[model samples]
Target: MRIIHVAVIAMLVFAAAYVYRIKMESTVRTEKVLQLHAEVRKEREAIAQLRAEWAKLDAPGRLQGLAERHLKLKPINARQFDQLKNLPERPPSIVNPGDPDPIASMIEKIDPDIITGSLPVPEAAH
Candidate 1:
């Protein structure tokens, strides 16, 4: 065959092979996209079903009925609350306002006996 004709044939063969590869790739990708779309639709349906179930489970009337049947709670009376004057006084603070905080000073003092099973660490400067 002539040199130019052979080169043209080779180029045609290369172009056909590349086009076939691209077609196959696109087909595979299209199938994968279809599968993902179906999966997403199925998942959305499952979510909708779960939401419906949750709504049924969380209904206030249903919860009240369950509580009444299981808890067996009694109704409250008007006299359940005590008057403000009958309430007990608040307890006094352990450390007086005039005195320095003893608890804070104790927390600041790090114990030397507390070990970390390693080399001695330098204490933070005051």
Candidate 2:
């Protein structure tokens, strides 16, 4: 009867130790999770700040100002516009009509069997 009592006490002690260890591990993990959440919040705030700066930098007026200052460009004038019909006719074709296409000759040099594999086609199922 005393032996049985001692065994029960030992088992209870072991269970208590296991529960304490699990509680400690859970507490550590909880702290790590909280730290990660804080880091994520900080990263989100940084991204918001960068987006605000990007909006300021990408404003159309700011871009036009930068282009005018750096590129020394001028705005379009009414005289600059021209009718498409006023454009000159395209120049004559460079290749002679008698000449065969160079690309076609290069393709003809390769074996047709190599392109469409040497494997026999399977018979069509009924």
CA lDDT, every prediction? Answer: 0.89, 0.89
Off by over 4 Å in 1: 94-126
Backbone clashes counted, model 1: 0
- Candidates in order, TM-scores: namely 0.72, 0.67
**Candidate 2: where are CA atoms >4 Å away?**
92-126
Question: How many collisions per candidate?
Answer: 0, 0
**Relative to the unseen true structure, what is the C-alpha lDDT of residue 39 in candidate 2, on a scale of 0 to 100?**
100
Error of 2 at 54 (Å): 0.8
Residue-level lDDT tens digits of model 2 in 14-121: 999999999999999999999999999999999999999999999999998899889977879999989999999999655556657956655666676564758687
The prediction achieving the highest TM-score against the true structure is: 1
The 10-residue segment of model 1 with minimum total lDDT is 92-101
